[model samples]
Target: MPKAELGSTYWNNRYISGKTGWDLGEASPAIVAYFASQRNKDAKILIPGCGNAHEAEALIQLGFTNITLIDISEELVSTLQSRFAKNDSIHVELGDFFEFSGTFDVVIEQTFFCAIDPALRSKYVHKMHQLLNKGGKIVGLMFNREFPDGPPFGGTQKEYKTLFSGKFNTKMDECKRSISARLGSELWVQFDKI
Candidate 1:
């Protein structure tokens, strides 16, 4: 976990200073592939801590109809709301994700998990449970490695499995389709609220 609480102000400054190394500029291919396989175009999907939201863009491209994006950074969400203003299929809101509320059939986890303070991992698990409908699942990529210091606090599958154990039906596999640079370090994670 970070010595300082990784909060709205900290994240806002990251974007302002252009320190967003986590902004992939495009959707993670593995995640996009998963979206491509989803048959329901109208599934209610939420992307928390959504940065730049390339995955949301991909979801729109793939014909998804209801996508919600929430983030703590006002600067980023303002730009996002403006960016998607004309699109009814995507909704952008500026707020702390932990306090944000909505129920969804699917939650997309891109780099968001790694970006949170590790000490809040269990809180994250509880929040996700509350946000999802029964049988609804969270699917996307997570780091399978560790970072020296981070907003991108990394973790191994063992930790994740333990964290989610009683609350979800979890499945994780080494992500086979991660973009070249991230391929080896990523895991494809799916956790259905149990």
Candidate 2:
């Protein structure tokens, strides 16, 4: 149940207008730190709603060989496709994340979840479950505070616990020490599929 203002077109418009406040310009520091110690260099990774795909770029540099990035907006996809054109290890697609099917060892979430309609949070949880291989995890950040008006919709830890509990074994959910500008305002999460 997506809210009217948070539909694909709404997001598309955000991209079209260059109004993406969530774009971090660089890969998230927290994700970079997590991957720094990662032993698996060939794991299949998915980054749904990947805006500029800074994370995918970082993963490529880390020697990752399989990375898939998906987004519903063709506008953003075109730009990213061009950006990642020379990278054989990264695949970019324009499609709805919920309908995209694939198996991955790691699915990274950035500002995506909070940008969608709150009613669809369960769908997001279930979709992540469906896309991941057993023991695979979703690692990244989620907003810890609610917004006044949003495609940047927000929620608390309690809501996330109920949203993800049955489908995933929550491994970590706490404030991250390395978040940028929005310090102390984000939840660093790592939910492994059960």
Tell me the tens digit of each residue's lDDT in model 1 across 50-127.
999999999999999999999999999999999999999999999977898899999999888888888788999999
For every model shown, the clashing-pair count is: 0, 0
User: In order, what is each prediction's RMSD in angstroms?
Assistant: 1.1, 1.6
- What tens digits encode model 2's per-residue C-alpha lDDT throughout 84-159? 8998899999998879999999999889998777788899998999999988999988888899787688788888
Pairs that collide in candidate 1 are none
- Stretches off by above 4 angstroms in model 1 are 1-4
User: What shift in Å separates residue 38 of candidate 2 from its native position after superposition?
Assistant: 0.6
Candidate 2 residues lying further than 4 Å off, grouped into runs, are: none
Model 2 / residue 84 / CA error / Å: 1.4
Backbone clash tally (model 2): 0
